[model samples]
Target: SDYSQEPPRHPALLVNSKEPFNAEPHRSALVTSYVTPVEFFYKRNHGPVPIVDDIDKFSVSITGLIENPKELCMKDILRLPKYAVTATLQCAGNRRTAMSKTRKVKGVGWDIAAIGNAIWGGAKLADVLELIGIPKFSYISPCGGKHVEFVSIDKCKEENGGPYKASIPLSQATNPEADILLAYEMNGETLNRDHGYPLRVIVPGVIGARSVKWLDSINIIAKECQGLFTQKDYKMFPPSVNWDNIDWSTRRPQMDFPIQSAICSLDDVNNLKPGKITIKGYAVSGGGRGIERVEVSIDGGKTWVEASKYQKAGVPYISDDESCDKWAWVLFEAEADVPESTEIVAKAVDIAGNVQPENVEVIWNLRGILNTSWHRVHVQIGR
Candidate 1:
């Protein structure tokens, strides 16, 4: 059975791009409950999945501006102490559909499903860098001047480039709070080929594109990655900018997702025998600032109500100690008296005073990113 060809069985999935790659997820999966299982998690890929047969032979190379360029085999990397984190990976284009609604955009028409939460286990990037004599503070000092570039093992001969590569600012790469990982395992098992086998980079709090798959090499530099993924694509621009007038260099690569949230439930229009309808969803902010609160609005953003709150997803250690962890998502819920109306709308706010926009038009960009507007659902009210 080629599991790769199988379609996802989740009922709530909203399909976006489909081909050698498919991006989708249960719209309400994030807040319907905590702990999104590996199977139900969203999948995003830039190319066909590569098949790897030998884990022992696989190795990762660290090069560029480092004092000692080192190549470590998978077996050696496993010898070090391992840590686990429950982090969410969201594609920069997660809500492309919301942008398309306003005007035509240029890439995969992703819905909210391009995001997923996972419990990743691997050696901390800082610990590894320390072994190679890379100073922890060097990332922060502008004088040291280093950028960490991630190169995927997956390769293809493209008309314009060699393979997909992405980079993050050195400060983000070395932050202990970032919890960056040379991940060999996902959801407790070895990574699937589509997910990057042998090794991959898991960069928490950044867009998914930066977390390159099929890990091969890490290079330190004084400038941002010039690859297509980092420079020519995955950026945000004013909604007024069109394809003909786009100035790629004027835009910066996206990092640190903005404060965002969505509604996960609605009244069953067909069976409208409801006393009350409950709203549930997840809210999160990037750059390690935990979600402070989630507020729900029933009538488009005119009136607001507070939702019940809980810890972010994939946090297994939260049960043991809460203080050690500072970031993730906050699940929320609110119940509203269902009026005999045609539709219900919901929006949420995060800790940093950032609230979802009232409508998509106000925040819509040409690339279809940062679509954190109110999510609406239509339902009939009858017995």
Candidate 2:
């Protein structure tokens, strides 16, 4: 019953779970700013948050596939180059409740606000590894590995009854421009206990699961993460599959999330007043792909209207003249006049031409991990 070490959360958050806390802010209250306040940021935890005693003395072990298998204290990591990355962390289950409507799925049912944007400041994961120095040797060195695994301090029963762990491809981890961070701070302040106090892996443009928190060790392995999450979950399946005939092996784990956008305004249909109503929300594309357009269709997908766009100040995910990287999200707003009743829907198109499917049936899976289908909200339009 005692979650004192879990960090104080905003009372306004809609409680999803208590022990391994999982909650999200009311959608309307969360869209006032481009940067989500950490307190109101959605909390998704799979296990008990470990109580860290000494943050400054916190150490992380780097082992396997590298010449210098050394330990890095907090001080050692800070000495590396510091970089700032603005990104949005969305649980793979964001909007699972919507998918649950079509058919029952076994997972946390998160609404639209299950995603939040934050400014992460820390040493580049690549730079820190460079300082440690990977031995100049063949790929088949003594402990040659193709993936970088991050093991968190939090103990969870779901993951083989051990600490939670996840991994990214070595190529992605080694790329300087990959923008991966050994983040210690969030929104210009020290990370809250609930958000990984001492350290966490900030894997931009990827699912939040990949960003392991309370990072205790880094393992380089020749194979992808064998963690239960990587192996048995976060995957997509066909509509026909059920528990009896399910085969997780046939499907690959979800890495980069596809194009996603949501309507964060107007929580209830009865709350609608009348006439033309202005709606606001956020949109994001994965894998550094930018949102080229966000279209809102109050009359279902038959007709659409372009939404005015906004991105985090100072950081532009997409730019002109020269090339810049995009791992963050873009906020948007659209105004429309409504009548009696209607289905308000919005879909996003990323720069890569990825569009959200018009309906959930085509994208529906058993677990509802990646519900990137067009986000919709039915409203009995008021007078």
lDDT of each: 0.71, 0.83
Q: Distance (Å) between predicted and true CA of 43, model 2?
A: 0.8
lDDT per residue, candidate 2, 1-383, as tens digits? 23566767788899888877899999986678888899888888887788898777789999987776999999998888888888889899999998999988989889888889999989888787777784322233223348889999888868755898998877778778889999999999998888887899999999888988899999988888888989888888888989899988887677798899988886645456558887778889889888888999988778999887777444544433134437777888889988658888888898889999888888888888788888777778555
Could you estimate the TM-score for every candidate? Answer: 0.89, 0.93
TM-score of 1: 0.89
Best by TM-score: 2
In terms of lDDT, the best-performing candidate is: 2
